[model samples]
Target: MADEKGENPVTVMVVDDHPMWRDGVSRDLEAAGFTVSATAEGVESARRRAAAVQPAVVLMDMNLPDGNGADATTAVLEVSPKSKVLVLSASAERDDVLDAVKAGASGYLVKSASVAELLEAVRATFDGQAVFTPGLAGLVLGEYRRMSTAPADDRAPELPRLTDRETEVLRLVAKGLSAKQIATRLSLSHRTVENHVQATLRKLQLANRVELTRYAIEQGLE
Candidate 1:
């Protein structure tokens, strides 16, 4: 059932400066059927291991040695385009959250999340959706709305915008369907599903599937 819905186990990278936290995260994900492809502490190690493993998603900490997690997000994304970074921090500060998003994080989650919530977030991230914990989603959307209303600054032209088909694809994405699974459900080929995903990303100006998920939620697409 899970595989059919594209809920198959995902490959993940866990990055935290705390050893116990890392171990706990790894254990939780593993128990939930995901493979912990790699584990790293601090900035340099996270960057190096993320490049090496190229996992589908990265669980990152906001504070790290050598650099901030936001900084690490940029480096990891550069090396692994398929990977989405989700900030797991103790902070609920708007500055910290916005900083991580600006640095290319797909989502920001407070460390208070339950194992179930973490599992869902990781799966959602894998499925091309951003999965922020409860309160943070509003913060992100409010920021985007504010930015949209801001004076014409140097920001790039608005993204192309999602087509009707693309919107449907995104809805399915939120349901945790992989490209292949989504294709089967929609009676399209896997390549077509991939194309739709890529188009959605382009339209939303998201770096990866994780941000795409968040965008869908913010826009009430799903």
Candidate 2:
């Protein structure tokens, strides 16, 4: 399970009000070579246990008994900044998806996903990719693009000044280019492309590639 530092077999915490769902998710993750750090039924318990364990990923249900999962995501991240929250909810509502993203969730997956899909989403979220249920990624990105026309204050802050290279990388990212593709297009190494992306994320305080793409669109970089 765990390495010498007890960190191997990535740690996961399951937060859902339904006992059956929670237990099943935990079981699946454990079987997939993850350490089930903790399980909780609602926001407060999730927050407390998450702070204590600081799991690498959190599988959260949107409609918790005590509060919405978005709020719980915010609270949990406040305590465990490195933990990625992936919403596993029944709702695929646009507002729900947007809210989770704005609250800093790393991904959103509706309950209709197959076990394999869910597992893949968990891995993607842990790897800092922004996973979304089918059709939902376009919805979120479109909403951000629409918001580009709003008043300046209505949008997120302008990214801290980026170098010309960083800006170019960001534009490519917004255009849906992968790191490898961007590297080849720009005549840069893949590692260099990834470095620029991370720098952009840090400067803009964005969580993942999805948010970075949203920012690029909002800034008219795409």
Candidate 3:
């Protein structure tokens, strides 16, 4: 983890099949003060480079040479459980987004993302805040809401309900507050905010911060 002053550089790995996009993003991130630890063009290469670099975060393209980003995400998680994965892809189709989440991505962004937004996404992902393209956020949340309303008997009964406190935390999350910022606002410890976030995810049957952010936005938490 980097220092609280935001001057300490966070190590990052860039995974994309296109050399142009990969190199451009790497240069952008480097200019933003994040250390570019490694760059890879496919799932296999990503796995190997991730292992060698042990980056704090990874910016991955959805389509790769050897395998898709979803496959690479699973591999990277296996090798670096603590490293945050942010999917930077062009596809916003329901299946691709959901599959990437299932494979353990902390956030999702389309390739059209501006350099500023990409930098913000990386920081947000590291701080345990989920991110998604503004347009796709609704689609993802609507899908979840639709799925969340299916036959009661089809799913678990004790669908963990969010405590009021957790809902408050969710609101802050949707507003792009980092865990530390949320804690400060709530007058709680940072770890407490993180705990609420985890508990909220469990209750909502969501995968990570990205999903949580989408849901919160749909529910007008922001």
lDDT (CA) per prediction = 0.78, 0.84, 0.82
Model 1, 163-200: lDDT tens digits are 88998998776544568888999999999999999888
Estimate, for each residue in 179-205, the C-alpha lDDT of model 3 and write its tens digit.
998999999999999999999988888
Count of steric clashes across candidates, in order: 4, 0, 2
Q: Give me the candidate number with maximum TM-score.
A: 2
Runs with alpha carbons beyond 4 Å of true place in candidate 3: 5-8, 168-222
Ranking of candidates on lDDT, top first: 2, 3, 1
Error of 2 at 128 (Å): 1.7
Q: Which model scores highest in lDDT?
A: 2
Model 2 accuracy (lDDT, Cα): 0.84
TM-score of each: 0.69, 0.78, 0.77
**Which residue pairs in model 3 clash with each other?**
130-209, 130-210
Question: Candidate 2's error at 188, in angstroms?
Answer: 8.1
Worst 10 residues of 2 by lDDT: 213-222
Residue 221, model 3, lDDT: 51
Per-model C-alpha RMSD: 5.9, 3.8, 4.6
Clashing residue pairs for model 2 = none
